[model samples]
Target: MDGFDRFRAPPPDMLVMRPLDSMVAIFHRPSGRTHVVASPVPEILESLGPDPTDVATLLARLSERFDLAAGDREALLARLGELEAAGLVERL
Candidate 1:
């Protein structure tokens, strides 16, 4: 897969979350670190479900849940890269 076409969220049990006003506090069990995130970060993780997915499929899943602009592709990719770096998402 090219350009981040294969990715997945960590298992559901690996994460614990708390809503903090406009942001979210995420406890990543494996990393033993808490990450504060906003907007598409959590949404991306949720949309990833329990399976690895390509970028197109992931975008379709997200679109089903939110009004994603056509131009948001780059932003989506950037966010996925960020999540991957943070260990919140995994590359396959």
Candidate 2:
């Protein structure tokens, strides 16, 4: 994959998001599971639209709305991995 992984959220109807104080509760319809996510995780999910997006593009989109640190790239990659594992996001 050249280490430039692309990701996309499932269809809107497949997931339901609810905001809690510092976390978001996401219900994955297909799995009948709910995931509790925090911080950049929620932002990341919100940034992903219907189209698949690469890391660079996703970072750009996030930057427009949030103040990101230089080390965020590594953190983002790690979070994406977590989200993928949780079925919250799909790696395309």
Candidate 3:
């Protein structure tokens, strides 16, 4: 997908996540498994929630929190995609 396409969020019921001090804990209740991943920046963890956040919103928040350059933003998003693909986090 192109960069613009990457900005799209996944559907709800795909995953759930909770942020801790230096990491984000993702739970896949349906599969009865969890993943604990260290965030690149602690601020990113703070921006996540039980509520839904679209990819654009997430990137925007990250930019504001970390002042990340475009490349950094894309890289961080790639990591998030990996987590999502693992079913650790859902689109909702």
User: lDDT: which candidate is best?
Assistant: 1
What are the clashing pairs of model 2? none
Put down candidate 2 lDDT per residue, 1-92, tens digits, no spaces.
32489999888888899999888998999999999888887788889865799989998999999899998888888888889999888998
lDDT of 3 by residue, 1-92 (tens): 23343322323354466777767776656776876777552244346544566667777777776766757656866766775686544444
Ranking by lDDT, best first?
A: 1, 2, 3
**Local distance difference test, each candidate:** 0.87, 0.86, 0.57
Q: Return the candidate ranking by TM-score, descending.
A: 1, 2, 3
Model 3: residue 62 alpha-carbon error in angstroms: 1.3
lDDT of 1 by residue, 10-77 (tens): 88899998899999999999989999999878899899966989888998988999988877777788
Error of 1 at 42 (Å): 0.9
Predictions: Cα RMSD each:
1.5, 1.5, 4.8
- The model with the greater TM-score, 2 or 3, is 2
The worst-scoring run of ten residues by lDDT in candidate 1 lies at: 1-10
Question: What is the alpha-carbon lDDT of model 1 when measured against the actual structure?
Answer: 0.87
